[model samples]
Target: MIEALIVGAGVSGLSCGIRLREAGIAAQIWARDMPARSTSSVAAAVWYPYKAYPEHLVIGWARTTYDELMVLRHDPASGIHVRNGHEIFPWQVDEPWWSGAVPSYRRITPAELPAGYRDGYVFEAPVIEMPIYLDYLRQRFEALGGTIEPRTLASLDQALGASDLVVHCSGLGARLLAADSTVFPIRGQIVRVTQVALDTFVLDDYGPSGMAYIVPRSSDCILGGTADEGMEDMAPDLSTAEAIQARCRALEPRLGAAVVLEHKVGLRPGRPTVRLEREQLAGGKLLIHNYGHGGAGVTLSWGCAADVARLIAQA
Candidate 1:
């Protein structure tokens, strides 16, 4: 049986497994920890990916995956559902910016907002409880006979010898293995709060030219801070955590003093461009590199994975 080894069990890695399985290929997803421990899993897991990537393949993949996810939204086991969402902008984005994918995205009237808020927009989209969603993906992968093993791999030689073909979804791990210095870590911290009142997701157009959003999943709402180009540190910094809270509070003064469910941080893998190319290693090992997603792993997974799969097939 043809087999592939996928490093980093994040969205891209699992998507690679899914596509390969559908194509009648045998694959396994290997990671240092559980797949959910990946940096992509830290994502708020909102569906619409603004400024994530412009790659034609990546964009198409996101749309395909999101469409498929929409189907499973009604299934309680799926961990996905459509909720009314909001994006509060201090100013309007260009008309072309709307692209009509933001589900009824429009400026809110003064009557619709609480006092002190100028304007906002509303839309309908899928929100991901990533903890649950990752579990769902793992079940599907395992059911398909895709094996997952946790091993700390330090070199490409280790990966080259492990499987017939390797899909490097290693995210930041690609830097050392792929010898890709262009890929670096973009740190992000978030404070999760239990806000039952936060029924909808709020996309905030603020925080360093607008990279932050308050996402309400099942049990907790996530407030984010994007600290790009930082060393990888999973532990949360109180200063950064406070800034995230302050930014989110501006979005919702109503949810005052919400309990801090948790505070977590992760480093997003960033490259000048998302690398989705395949190469033959020194030992004639098949290698398809698929990392550098930055903050859009969930958003770009299927699109990027499809392209990675095609690149392999063509080879």
Candidate 2:
């Protein structure tokens, strides 16, 4: 029986573990931190392709993920929901390359535009409650005969020695393990507030006001954030939190004095482009690299995992 080992247990690794097992390969995930404790959990986790490139491949992967997420959204236990939201733009622009992936996408009318936005679009997309969704993925992986081990890897060579095929989903850990200098950290911070009676998410990441988004889950809403490139500090800046709250309130006046729940900081795995290719090593061992997804780790999770499984089969 061929066995495979997947490093890192964030959304990417867990998704790959599930798919590999479904492909009739025995696979296990070994991670330094559990999925819930990883950066994937800290994400607002709405399904939008952000900060990932080259546009050609990313659109395909994002479309695949969108279709899969739509199926998962029907299952309440999956912590996935197709919520209506808007992505605001400061200037008139054509629809995004991945706009076709969304089932319901349309330009916002002149009346719908916010105070300073020239154009916008409204669409329904999957919004994942990270904590619950991580658990859902974990349960699904175990049910599919995949296993999770609490282990840390020192280098890719160590993983290659143990299994016939090794999948590297190590996120930012790739900087040290894969010796890829291009992989760095894009630090982000978010503030979680008490649940508001709102289902619509709002994103205004561009323009002079800086990055900001409001994502509502079942129990609470996430107000965010800051994208500080090359910063790895995991401490949530309270000032940033205040700024985020103020901006979100300005976007939607209904967020009046909502109680602050928690502040979170995560170091997003930043890279010029996502790496999802295979490398062959001595002794007939293979290493499939699938990390550096940046903020799209959740957005591209399922599609990337499916592709990784295909790579394993071809190897």
Candidate 3:
């Protein structure tokens, strides 16, 4: 039997741990932080493929993840909700490249467009409550006989002695762990607020404010955000949070009175493209790289994990 050691306890690593255990492989996760404290916890977590590349692979992975999330949505405790939403544009545009991945995707009529938007698409996508969802995933992974230890690795080589395989899901830590210079941070800031009687999400990727989105969950709503490339500060900015609320309120007036809950900042692991390939270590152990998911980490989690399991099985 092969045992796998996975790095990172974010969505990607947890998802991979579950898949590997399901595939009859013993898996353990070691990470610098637990799921609740990882960067994934800061995501607004709507199921749209954002900031991931190589269109063909991203579409496939996104579609697969969509299917998985749809299944999980059936369980009330999963923190997954399939909600109606709009992705409005400031100018007339064709359907999105990821339109096919969504089962309920359709161009909204001009009458449905919000003020100041010329085109939009309405779709039903999963809006994940990251806090609850991460807890759910942690429980599910542990239920499957997998364990997650809080440990930080100085390099990929540190885990090779304990397992036949090391699966790298380190996200931005890949820059140092995998020695991949292409991995950089796409800084994002979001403000969480009390649910403002808003059930539907509103996304304005090309709006005047730039990349604003409203993701409503079971309890609260997540309003976000900024995509400042190469920005690395994890500290939440007061002005940025104010700007985010202002942009979200412009989209949905009800948010104007929404009570503020908390503010968060996360560094999305941006890369030219997601790295999901295998490598041979010096001692005949296998190393699988599975990082640099950018903003689509949750959107691509299960799909990438399934592929990672396949690679280990074949090896």
Overall lDDT per candidate, in order of appearance: 0.75, 0.89, 0.91
Query: Residues 1-315, candidate 1, lDDT per residue (tens digit)?
Result: 237888888878888888888777788877886777877678887886644555554556667767777787878986887887776655545443433444455666777664445667777778888888888878888888888888788886676687769888988888888888888888888888887577777776553434557787777788876656757777789987777777777667754677888888888888777888888766667889888887778767767777877888887
lDDT score, candidate 3: 0.91
| Model 2 TM-score relative to the real fold | 0.97
Q: Model 3, residue 62: what's the lDDT?
A: 95
lDDT computed for candidate 1 = 0.75
Q: What local lDDT score does residue 119 receive in model 2, on the 0 to 100 scale? A: 90
lDDT of 3 at 210: 70
For model 3 the TM-score comes to 0.98
Provide the TM-score for each candidate, comma-separated. 0.89, 0.97, 0.98
Ranked candidates (lDDT, high to low): 3, 2, 1
RMSD for each of the candidates: 2.7, 1.2, 1.2
Tell me the lDDT of candidate 2: 0.89
Q: Write the per-residue lDDT of candidate 3 for residues 1-315, one digit (tens) a residue.
A: 337899999999999999988888889999999999999999989998999987899999999999999999998888999999988998889778999998898888888887889988999999998888999999999999999998888898787777769999999999989888999999999999999778899888888877799999888999999999999998999998999988888889899889999999999999999999998777679999999898999999999999998888787
- lDDT per residue as tens, model 2, 164-282: 79999999999989999999899989999988798999999884568789999998999998888999888888888888988888888888768999999998998999999998877
